[model samples]
Target chain A: AQSVAQPEDQVNVAEGNPLTVKCTYSVSGNPYLFWYVQYPNRGLQFLLKYITGDNLVKGSYGFEAEFNKSQTSFHLKKPSALVSDSALYFCAVNYGGSYIPTFGRGTSLIVHP
Target chain B: DTAVSQTPKYLVTQMGNDKSIKCEQNLGHDTMYWYKQDSKKFLKIMFSYNNKELIINETVPNRFSPKSPDKAHLNLHINSLELGDSAVYFCASSQAQTRNEQFFGPGTRLTVL
Candidate 1:
C-alpha cells in the first residue's frame, strides 16, 4: 500500500517570503509523487509531479518541489509567497504497479500580505 | 474549455437517501478517478475507471458505486448514505500513457444529515 504524509497541519508565511510545505511517502517500488493545491470550495489542482530524474521539479504558479530519495520526502517550495497562494495543499503518491493514488491530509497555507 | 466538470456542486440529503454525482472530462484522458475529502481535509481515493472499465476500487463500502458508460463521463452513485458520507467528492482524470498530471473537477459537497 502506498501512503503519503504531510507533517504540518498549517503553514503560515508572509508575502515576499519563502514558503515550504513538507511531505513524505511510503511505497513498495518506485514512487510517483505529486503536489496539488485547492482553493476554497474547489477541487484539487495539480501543481507538480516527480516521476523520474531531476530531484527538483517546477510547476504551475511559481511552485516547485524537491524529491529526496534518501529521506523519502517531497517538499513544496516557493521563492516568494503571495496572498493568492494561500490555499490547502496536498501530497499524493502512486506506486509503480498501482493505478490508484493515495493522498495526505492537506496542509492549510496562509500567506499574509 | 473546461477540462473536467462535475454536476451538483452542492448536495444535501437525509440519511438513507440515494444520490448521484455526474462527472465529465474533455481532456480526452483514459483514466478517471473518484476521491473523497473529509471535514478534516483528509483526501482518499475511492474508485478509478479506465476506458469505461472498472480498474481500481478501494475499500469503500458497497453503498458507493461508480459508473462509466463512456470514456468522457463517469458517475458516482451512493445508496443509503450515512453521516460519515458527508464530504467533498472530487472527479479527476489523467492520461494513462503520457503526463499523468491529474486534472480535477470542481467537486460535489455532499452533506448527509
Candidate 2:
C-alpha cells in the first residue's frame, strides 16, 4: 500500500518571505508525486508533478517542489509568498503501476501581509 | 469550459436518506476517480474507474456505491446516509496511460443532519 504524510498542519509565512510545505511518501519502487492547491470552496488546481526527470520540478504560480529520493520527500517551495498564496495544499503520490493516488493530509498555508 | 464538473455543489439531507452526486469530465480522459475529503483535509480515494470498468475500490462502507456509466461520467450514491458521511466529495479524471496529472471537479459538499 502507498501512503503520504504531511508533518505540518499549517505553515505561516510573511509576505515576500520564502515558504515551504513539507511532504513525504512511502511507496514501492519509483513514485509519481503531485502538488495541488485549493482555495475556499474551490476545487483543487494542479501545481506540478514529478515523474522521472530532474529532482527539481517547477509548477504554476511560481511554485516548485524538490524531489528527494533519499528522504522520500517532495517539498513544495516558493521563493516569495503573498497573501493570495494562502490556501490548502495537498501532496499526492502514486506508484507507476497503480491508477490510485494517495493524498496527504493537507497543509494550510497562511501568509500574513 | 470546465474540464471536470460535478452536480449539486452542496447537499443537505437527513440521516437515513439516500442521495447521489453526479460527476462528468469533458477532458477525454480514460480514468475517473472519487475521493472523500474530511474536515481535517485528509483525502482518501473511494473508487476509480477506467473505461467504465471498476479499477480501484477502497475499503469503503457498503452503503457508499459508485457507478460509471461511461468513460466520462462517474456518480456516487450513498444509502442510509450517516453523520459520519458528511464531507466534501471530489471527482477527478486523468489519462490512463500516463496518469500523471488529474483534473478535478468542484467538489460536492454533503452534509448529513
Candidate 3:
C-alpha cells in the first residue's frame, strides 16, 4: 500500500519570504509524487508532480518541490511567498505502476502580509 | 472553460436519504476519479474509472456507489446516507490511468445530517 505523510499541520511565512510545506511518502514500488492546494470550500488544485526526472520539479504559481529519494520526501517550496498563496496544501503519492493514489492530511499555509 | 466541473456544489440531506453528485471533465482525459475529503481535511481516493469502465474501487462502504456514464462524466450516488458521509466529495480527471496529473473539480460539499 502507498501512503503519504505531512508532518506540519500548518506553515507560517511572511510575504516575500521563502516558504516550504513538508511531505513524505512510503510505497512498495517507485513513487509518483504530487502536490495540490485547496482553498476553503474549493477543490484540490494541482501544483506539481514528480515522475522521473530532475530532483527539482517546478510547478504552478512559482512553486517547486525537491524530490529526495533517500528521505522519501517531496517538500514544496516557493522562493518568495504571497498572501494569495495562503491555503491548505496536500502531498500525494501513487505507486509507480498503480492507479491508486494516497493523499496526506493537508497542511494549512498562512502567508502573512 | 473549467477543466473539471461538478454540480450541486453544496448538498444538505438527512440521514437515510439518498443523494447524488454529478461530475464532468472537458480536458479530454480518459480517467476519472472520486475523492473524499473528511472534516479534518484528510483526502482519500474512493473510486476510479477509465473510459466509462470501472478500474479502481477503494474500501468504501457499499452505500457509496459511483457511476461513469461515459469517458467525460462520473456521478456518485450514496444510498442511506449517514453522518459519516458528511464531507466534501471531489471529482477529478486525468489523461491516463497512471503517471498523469489529475485535474479536480471545485468539489461538492455534502452535509449528511
DockQ of each: 0.62, 0.70, 0.74
Q: Model 3 chain B, TM? A: 0.94
TM-score of chain B of 2: 0.93
Predicted complex 2: DockQ? 0.70
Worst 10 residues of 3 chain A by lDDT: A94-103
Lowest summed lDDT across 10 adjacent residues in model 3 chain B is found at B50-59
Error of 2 at A102 (Å): 1.0
Which stretch of 10 consecutive residues in model 2 chain A shows the poorest summed lDDT?
Answer: A95-104
On TM-score, the candidate that comes out on top is: 2
- Across residues A1-113, which tens digit of lDDT does each residue of candidate 2 receive? 78999999999999999999999999987899999999999889999999998999999999999999999999999999999999999999998778888889899999999
Candidate 2: which stretches are off by over 4 Å?
Answer: none
Over the stretch B1-113, how does candidate 3's per-residue lDDT look in tens digits?
Answer: 88899999999999999999999999999888999988898887899888546755647998988887788999999999999999999999997756687889999999987
Every model: Cα RMSD to truth: 1.6, 1.3, 1.5
Off by over 4 Å in 1: B52-58, B97-99
Residue-wise C-alpha lDDT for candidate 2, range B1-113, written one tens digit per residue: 98999999999999999999999999899888899988987788898788646865647998988888878899999999999999999999999854478999999999999
Better of 1 and 2 by DockQ: 2
Give the winner by lDDT.
2
User: What would the TM-scores of all predictions be?
Assistant: 0.94, 0.96, 0.94
TM-score of chain A of each: 0.98, 0.98, 0.97
